[model samples]
Target: MAIKGSGSPMEAVDEYFDMLIKSRFIEMFGDIKTNSKGWKCHKLGELGSFKTGGTPSSKHEEYYQGTIPFISTPALGPNYIDDSAAKYHISKEAIENCATTLIPAGSLIIGTRINVGQSSINKIPMCTNQDIVSMMDIDKKYDLLFLKHCLNQYIPYLDSQKKGATIKGITVELLKSVMIPEPPIDEQKQYVDFVEQVDKSKAVCK
Candidate 1:
C-alpha cells in the first residue's frame, strides 16, 4: 500500500513506521474477513453501547462560547485524544439545547460520517458533532486498545461499504453489526504491550 505524500524525510519516516505497525497487526490476526486463525467472532454491538452525537445549532452564537471541547472527526488521533486535539469548544447550554451528549473521558470516539472508521480514545470529556459516534461503557472482557485495533482492521471494508454520494458515511447499524475476532483477555493484553513497544519506536523517530 503506497501512501502518497510530499516525500519529505519526516513524512517518509512516519509512513514507514505506519506501514510497519499495520503489517504487525496483520501478523497478529490474519485476514479479519476469513478469521483464518478461527478465533471466536462477536458483533461489535454485543460488546458495548453506542451513542451518536449531534451538532449544536449554528443559529445560536452562544453555543460555541464555553469551555467544553467539541470534538469532531478531524480531532481524532490514531490512539488517544485530549482537549488539545479539538478545534471547537462549546458551552453546557449547547449540550442541553442540542441532541449531543457529554461523552466521558476514555470513551472511544469513532467517526461515522465523512471519515468513517477514524477513531480515538478521548482523554477528556467532550461533546462531538453529528459525524461521530462513541462507544461507551465497553464490556469488561475486551481490552479497549485491542478493540480499537479490531475496528481499525475493518476500515478498508467500511470505506468500501460507505453510502452517500456527497459526504460518504456508514450507518450505525453497519458499525454495530461489524464482527471482530475475540481472543482471550491475556492475548489482547499481549498485543497491547507489543503496540506500546512499537509506539516507543515511533516516538524515537519523531
Candidate 2:
C-alpha cells in the first residue's frame, strides 16, 4: 500500500532504497543543523575579484566573425554548458577596443544581477557581458566547484530574500553577506569530488 510521502506501493519501496545512502554514506553526510551561528560568512567580493565584460558594437561587421568565445546570458544553460555557442566573435582589434577581461578555465562564473545565483565554470578561456560576475579564487581556500554547488543549493533561498521592485536582484552587500559552511579544506575537496563523480555519471546516463 502507498505510505505517507510515497507515490504508490512500489514507489514507497523505491523511496526506502535511498535509506541505504544514509546508512552507507554516513561519514559523508551529517546533521550539524544550526541557525547560522558559527559559520564564517563573507561577501562575494571578499572571496574573489570581480570582472565584467562588454559587448562589441554589433553594427560593426568586424565584430561578427572570429575565433574568440564571447559569452552572454543565454549560454549559461540549465545543465550542460556549451561554450562554443556564443553569438559574437571579435578580431584582435575588436578585443583591444572592448577590453573585456578574458576569464580563464576553472574560474567560477556567476550571473549576478538578473539571474542572481546561476553559475558555471568556464571550461575554456572566455569573455562575458556585464550581467555576469567572474570570480577568481584569491587564497585558494575555497574550491570553485564546491562554491558553485553551494550557490546552486542556496539560490532559491537567496532569490526569496531579494528585495527590489523592478530589477529583482541580489545586491553586492547581500551577496557578500551570504553564509557558507566552511568545513576544512580536505572536507571541501571530498564533497566536491563526490558531487563531480555523481554529475559525470548522470551526464553519461543522459
Candidate 3:
C-alpha cells in the first residue's frame, strides 16, 4: 500500500521506527556530545582493551580455505552480527602466520577506515582486516549495548575526525580520547532494555 506522501510503505515504516528510536534515545541521554545530562564522563579507550585488525596475505590460497570468518570495514554493520555476515573465511594456519588476530565473541568491531564510524557487535569469534578495530575486555561497570548506543551517537563527530591524504580514517588515539557519559549501571540496563523493545518493534516492521 502507498503512503500519503513520498516513499513506499516499507520505507515509511522504517523511517517511522527510526524516528521513534532516535527520539527515545535523546530523551534518555540528552546531548551526548556535551554531556548535557550531567553524568560522569569517561574516555572510551579507558573502558576496554583495543586491538587493531590486520589482513592476511592473499597470495597464500591456503589462508582462505578454512572456516574462521574474516570481517572487514565493509562488513561492520549497524547491529549484532555473526560469522555469516562476512564474505571471507580464514584458516587457523593463517592466524598463526599472519598479522590477523582472533577477537572474542561479543566484542565490538568498529570501522576505523572507509566508513569511519560504522560498528557492530560480533556474536562469534572472528578476525578482521586492517581497517577495523575490536574493543575487547570491556569494563563490567557498563553494559555492552549501552556503550554501542553511545558510540552510535558519536558517528557524526567521529566522521569529522577522519583524516588521511587518501583513505580517510580515524586513529586509535582519537577513539581513545573521545569521551562518553556514563550513567549508573542500572539506568544503562534500563535504556538497553528499552532499545531492545524498540528493535523488536522495528523487526516487526521489516
Name model 3 segments beyond 4 Å from true: 1-9
Cα error, candidate 1, residue 34 (Å) = 1.5
What are the per-residue Cα lDDT tens digits for candidate 1 across 45-111? 9888889899999999899999999988887647888888878899999999988999998788999
Better of 1 and 2 by TM-score: 1
- What local lDDT does model 1 show for residue 51? 91
- Local accuracy by lDDT, each model: 0.86, 0.64, 0.85
Estimate candidate 2's alpha-carbon lDDT, on a 0 to 1 scale. 0.64
Best by TM-score: 1
Per-candidate Cα RMSD to the true structure, in Å, reads 2.1, 5.8, 2.1
lDDT per residue as tens, model 2, 1-206:
34478876555654454333223223443322232335554545677877777777777788757777887766763323445657776665656777577787777777756777788888878877776777776447787766676666567766777677886766555665665556677877887666556556544544
Highest lDDT among the candidates is held by which one? 1
On lDDT, the stronger of 1 and 2 is 1
